[model samples]
Target: MLAFIKRLLIGRPLKSAELGEQKINKTKALAILSSDALSSVAYGPEQILIVLITVGMAAFWYSIPIAIGVLFLLTALILSYRQIIYAYPHGGGAYVVSKTNLGVNPGLVAGGSLLVDYILTVAVSVSAGTDAITSAFPTLHDFNVEIAIMFVVFLTLLNLRGVTESASILAYPVYLFVLALFILIAVGIYNILTGEVPQTLHTPIGTPVAGISLFILLRAFASGSSALTGVEAISNAIPNFKQPAPVNAARTLMMMGGLLAILFSGIVTLAYFYGIVPKAEVTVVSQIAEETFGRNFMYFFIQGTTALILILAANTGYSAFPLLAVNLAKDKFIPRMFLVRGDRLGYSNGIIILGLASILLIVAFHAETEHLIPLYAVGVFVPFTLSQTGMMLKWLREKPDGWVPKFVINTTGALISFIVTMMFFLTKFSQVWSILIFLPIIVLIFHRIKKHYDAVGDQLRLTTCERSPDIKGNVMILPVAGITHVVENSLKYAKSLNPDQIIAVYVAFEREDERKFEEKWEKWQPDIRLVTLHSHYRSILGPLTKFVDTVAHKAKEGDYQVTVVIPQFIPKKGWHNILHNQSSLLIRAYLLYKRDIVITTVPYHLKK
Candidate 1:
């Protein structure tokens, strides 16, 4: 969907040459990896506001302290993950960490969290995009929910087409979003310092909560920490990096961390100084643009740009979610569908599923963005803390020289991450915490499913009973087009089955039908009954279906076993287009309704 949008609107999809090669170098890797992190510039602040929404107006200003706290936590977390990228860059992010230390369950928690978060990223971005569009075109204000859905469908298809292709196409728009943020921040800061604070700047909105309660503070911090959602993308995609994977991965992580920190902090500070709040209420930034750039210029362009950035932020989710799913499946968490890569080059099933899931949430909630924030952070941070903790565990296990200092750094990372995750859990997953509650429950279901499959596979020990045992009086009946080589092969196979009787049957389409009279039945099954039914009316499937049905029925009544063998050709012929086609598929479906009676296919490969 992303690539299609780029091609449709931006002239063409970005080719390999656009980035100067077929290989994913450090620049491409970082761009791809950092996208999730960098995209926080658009939504991180929004998440903070979302958490504060219920408490009322004054809580909006709390975004600053919240962001400050998250930034401190994120700095420590990023440094820890850098160590992760260094240790295991072949792909597996938290799965590797958890598996290496705490075991697969915790690893899967990380994997599941990453997977869900990636999906939320898409939903949040598109929902925010609806707001941007509404701000620009008031007429669209009524259709924000519908528009977000349409855009999500578009994005899902782009991902189905291919992630690398989609990512390459999105790189520029994402860059544009960051560049737009930079411009906004630079201009806003300049205006603030010049004592020319925009006229649109308003005093902070009123807080619904009366006091500085601990719950409100925690909620505020949780909202601001939304910026941290995409930091794990690099670890998930370590394999996509070029040679010296670990080195490249670490470099990419560092670059992403620094750039995102700068952008996220800058955006938060600008929003604070300008007194911009979420559009659900004042939509402060858009209003600020009206003052600074003039209503004529900022009204349309800024609105358009903000929408583009929000949409692109979701692209960051598209990139991260599938990677997490694949890693989870690789480590035996999710089903194999997550492991299935489509023809165009992505986890098409996973992409569509995520997109559809996001749409359901958006519509179900009526695009109530703030109401969904609790469900938002719980899964993301479980993996975040686990991965960080895993890194600390790994570093501690290694215990190299200068181990004390490295251990100290890792322990600090682990402690901070654990605290953040614990706080999110207590704040988000209350018995009344509807959305957050389901996230873990679903994760548990997947874990049970994985365990079930592994156990079944382990118990499937083969024995001789798997093959036909009551063999002495058994007979193998083969259906053939005629006495062709397929008939001869069937005869040879029947002889191997060592049946007391061998019968070859054919339902004649026409007396002159070459297939029914092509070869010598006498030479192949000379001693057995080679029955033929005259098809005076050319009804192939009906007669064949009835004949097989009669044979099975008679066998049941007579206490004899029956097996039908049909000769299958390698390729379809021209006439097959008009005939009762997909005979094998249809027959298989019909046969599945039966209790027993094996039906086997003998392929007659036409050597090319």
Candidate 2:
């Protein structure tokens, strides 16, 4: 809990090898930044139809208006978030925006919302991809949940392999997706213009209501606006882009946003013109192709391309979520495990956490598009609303004269978004209230964390002498590694600690190690008492726990205080942790809980 809040914001949060520090090519950065927004285009229009279904299929064409409205919102969002990319090119994303402009409270809310939203990005894209696959292979229809979960797990492993590793893997699929989308749009537009409209277009029965109410319109807009959710990551991911960050990041955003907008608008228009309706029985894109091309080359190609792109879109979340978690852990809203890096300069813990959360979401909702959309949109909108508002606050605070255009753009974007946020809550209230419940919990958690940090800061503010309580008989217990010459090396440090008595303990995991150590003990003629215990369990922590408890209990025996000297070896890499000095941690935790026993570490370094 305490570790989460203590961040040295001065350096890169995770130190990188020259390998990890490798410059991101302009193309790859654009691909990573654009993939999320691009992949979202496939399902963005589908969301409108799903919401309209609640009103009944009769009014599905009404989705066209909603789709158009959503584009405006998306464009504004792109422009507004671009301000964020410019304002904070150092990365850390929404958390950075919130912290810099609004107070930490708002920043924390942004961070929390982004975390939830990022996982939903994975859940949404994977679930949507599962839908496409289920459509293509009807035999897999019933296994959407299983496939979605497996994909999440698969992605987790890919991410665990680390950032550059996963990025390299995703690059090809993303580029293919871009090309396929452009081809589909071009082909669809050409067919339409050349008077080759599909023969089998299924005409609708009736509009849900010939004249729709403002409420219904707003609901449809809320569903469609989910398309804009993935754009914020580019701003936050600026640090991952190559150096001279502001220019590179801004260009990436423009390329991503502009291409996504064109593709998205084209796809939406194509669906509408072709009378594509997303039925649980038949996916809209598949239906459109089958109607036009009669289950030939173009039909299957569209299906394959659509599915691949959606799958690649899920990868964006996998890439971004770990970076987001690291930022949150730095801020103290979550546990500190996020601070740890994997072998490839990746946040393995964050990746696992995101994977598990996405899997649970997929399982709980059974990867149903309609079921997941509400939860998904709510998570994303909260962050967008918060970040835009934060940007507005910044603009108002630092309204530089020459930057009037940006200030104008961001504030206008903020006002419209603020209204959109309130409207979505009202329109999506029933399906989205669960999100509202999470908001207060996040805020409360942040507040408690702040209190904890302040308290720790207060405690550590004392002078050096005052820092350690100068008790007359402060006994220290240290867990020994039982390695060669470690005991001999630890005794000197233990004596220097000014403890009453130091006992060197060993656990006999290997018979040879025990015999060799025993022979060394007798030959060295060391004055320190050597205690050895044999244990059968493979794990060292549990047995060490028992030994520490017994020793700590004995430490309260009058003037003869007991101090157990434990040796520790800290490793820089995760895989290098042989047993990870687990005995030391367990023994320290046990002794610290007991009265009159202080567990201390005697460090030993293995050859480099």
Candidate 3:
């Protein structure tokens, strides 16, 4: 029944041979890989004004300049990642590049940064999308967090169904969003050129609440840098593309960068022209849409598409995080469980974990985009700087054809990215300090995991001089709860092992219980010896394990071994097993790692 439900939710188990069918082409890849960056424009422009407006409504004019700076950084990263696609087509993105050129520690840092950013991508995107919904229908304002988490859960399940299926599901809405934004941008530009577009929603205040300074400008720039967060995802997911993976991925990256540039710049420019303030209930984009098209079909259409693209933007994180995790797992830096694919061939564990983490952030921050934005770009920028720096080093060492141009581009990108990363850390240090603190801790954990895996590999390594130990004989010890069919079957199975001796051990809490048990054993007349342990304290496992240890100690001297055969009842109904005591399971858990003792379970199915 459970299997049927799993099949229904996740689809039928996909064969390994069906993996190639999951690779997506340019159109689908664009939607799946670039959704995060594309949808970020909905809030990225607003994040600038959100920070700038704190000084005064007049400082809102700085949004366009801040956005342009963000655009420059975006251009550098897009070009740098294009080179990364061709260079590391196998696709670990920043992690692979940093590790190969920079070293192991740097690679882990890049990997950790991208992983955290992916979580934020989902959280921030869905939260902003929820903001859009509330903007359209203010009645949903109070339940924003709930709505955001629901989208994350839905995306998680969709992603777990496999890549191609998700791409097909998410592609059309992304195109619709792009079309809507372009139309809005074009109409706004035309209206502005023709002279005078009225702002009816809210008027811009000229009061200066606080003085503007360089630090404040930098903070605003850092906040607006959220626009550049998902640019590296294309490079991170080169392998997810169809044939000619790198070329397809590079083309997609260029296309994504171009669209993002126009949409982001256009939106910010319109917001400035229309005097759209970042309101708690209405978003900057929503305000711009209303001012441009005014609460008509086009206005609600923009809102609906914005909400969808923003929610689907999490698909970018779902695509990259698992792939990065698989690389880390292969490198022995994380748990091997991440290396296992689900029934649908998706990275199920990584997808589920990303969803849960996103949901946690949404709930923690109450699905507020501004609060989550400060913690957003720092993660991506760190990897951005590292990836570019790593590429520069690669060009220097290899000095391949046209290395100079490549080196200059990467060097410039690295410098700009490093400056922005520092700006993010310094300007928003109060909000971002936790990430800085946790980053090194995460790297330290990666190193510790690597050391443990290395030690395990060494211990398990095969050697020429090693030989299997010879067993002369063995003893079977059965811990019986009562005179039942399970015990009878367990005894029969134990006899088949041809042991040196068979001992049935029972622990009794009271004298009366022990007497009754002994009489029942005597009446059965079994050939096996019965050992009764009396305990006034009513501790079964402690006494049984101690007795087993003594028996094992004696067996070692005789050049034999002890095996505990436990009888586990199989109830007709699955839940009925919970009604019975689990002494057999407890006994096995107690002696699981003892050197001279072996434990096994014999199941006895109940006919009724």
Candidate 4:
């Protein structure tokens, strides 16, 4: 039934041979991979104004310069990642680059940062998407967190259907969002050209919450830097593209960057000219939409597309996080379970884990975009700086063709990214210090996981000089609850072993019960010996395990191995299992891993 439900939700299991068919072309790839980057235009400019408006309405003009600074950084990142696409065509992104060029520790740091970044991508995108919906229908504002989590669940199931299916599902909505933004931008520009100014739908905040200063501008710039967050996803996911994967991924990266630049700049420009100030319930983009198209169908269409693109932005995280986890698992830096793909050829474990983590964050922050924004860009910049620095080091060491220009480009990107990371730490430290503390801890955990896997590998490996131990005889003990067919079946199996000795052990809580069991065993009069243990504490496992330990000690002197057979009854109905004591399961659980003691279960199936 569970399998049927899973198949119904994610479609039928895909064949391994169909993996190549799942590789998406550039169009679908753009929609799936670039959604996160493109959707940032919906909130990225607003994040700057959100920070800047703290100093009063006069500071709103600062968004234009802050937006420009963010654009310059975006340009450097796009150019830097294009080089990464060509050089490391197999993907792995910052983790692979930092580990190869810098070292393992740096690599793990990059990996940890990216992991946090991907999770926050989902949380932030879903939250922002919910904000868009609430902006349209203010009555739904109370359920924003719940709405965000629902979207997370939907994206998780959608991605589990495999890359091709998810790309097909998500492509149209992303393209529609892009087209909507272009229309809004064109219409807004036309209004400006015709000297028709739009009014802000939100009340203007006349009071200043903060004083304008360099730090304020820096804070605004750092906030807006979120626009550049998803640019590296393209390089991380190069392998997901069709033939000429690197070339196709590079082209998509540039196209995404271009769209993001135009959309972000246009939105910020319109927000400035239209004098749109963010309201608590309404978003800056929503206000601009209402002003440009009024509270009409076009405005609601903008809101609908904005909500969709933001929610689908999580698809990028779903696409990238699992692949990154696969690389980490292959290196033994995380559990090997992540390396296993589902029947649909998707990393189901990673997808489910990402969904749950995002839900946790959405709940924690109450689905407020501003609360999550502080935690957003730091993780992104850590990998950005590391990846660009790794690329620069690669150019220096390898000295490939035109190494100097490549070195300069990456160096510029690395510096900008480092500066932005420091800016985040400086401006948002009170809120984001937790993330700074978490990075090293995650890196340490990575090392610990790798060490454990290495130790397990060492213990499991057999050497040329080692030989298997010889077992001369078997000493079998069968634990019987009462005289029944299940016990009879277990006894027959134990006798077939032809062990040195077979002991039928039973634990009774009452003296009368002990006598009754013993009498029945004597009346049966089989060739086997019966040992009845009386327990004042009425504990079954305690006495049974103690008796087994004593028997195992005695058998060791004769070079005989101890084996315990547990008799359990299998119920005809699933719900009937609740009626049984389940002591046999407890006995096996306790004795399954003991040295020199082997446990076996003999079950008699009952017909209803």
TM-score of each: 0.75, 0.77, 0.96, 0.96
lDDT of 2 by residue, 1-608 (tens): 23343232112344465544634656877666567788878777777776666765556667666766777777777787777777777677678887778888888778887788888888888888888888889999999888888888777777665555567777787877777667777888889888787634523434346545677767777777777778877777776677787778788877888888787787777776686767884677777667666778777877887786776677778767777777777777677788887655677788788889988888888788777767777677777777777777777777766566776666666665666677767876787787778877987887787678767767788753455423446455445554456555677787787766656666778878878887777666466666666678765666666876676566555444556566666565546777554655666666577655555677666664
lDDT (Cα atoms) of all candidates against the true structure: 0.68, 0.72, 0.90, 0.89
lDDT of 4: 0.89
Arrange candidates by lDDT, highest first: which order?
A: 3, 4, 2, 1
Output the TM-score of candidate 3.
Answer: 0.96
**Root-mean-square deviation of candidate 2:** 7.9
lDDT by residue (123-237, candidate 4, tens digit) is 9999999999999999999999889989999999999999999999899999999999999999998997787884442223342335788888888888899888888898888
Model 3 lDDT per residue over 1-608, tens place? 99888888789989999999999999999998999999989988988888888886778777767887988888888889999999999999999999999999899999999999999999988998998999999998999988998899899999999999999999999999999999999999898878767554223544344588888888788778888889999888887888899999999999999999999999998988888888888988999999888889999999999999999998999999999999999999999989999999988999999999999999999998878877888888998899999999999999998899889889999998888788878877888899878899999999999999998887677863555567789989999889988898999899887888999999999989999999999889467899999986898988898999999888888778889999998888988878988777777887897887889999998877
Q: CA lDDT of 99 in candidate 2?
A: 79
Error (Å) of candidate 3 at residue 562 is 1.2
With a 3 Å backbone cut-off (N, CA, C), the pairs that clash in candidate 4 are none
Q: 1 or 4, which is superior by TM-score? A: 4
Off by over 4 Å in 1: 1-23, 50-62, 198-210, 281-284, 425-474, 477-561, 565-587, 590-597, 601-608
Report how far off residue 172 is in candidate 2 (Å): 1.9
Off by over 4 Å in 2: 1-15, 19-21, 53-61, 198-211, 461-465, 471-561, 564-589, 599-608
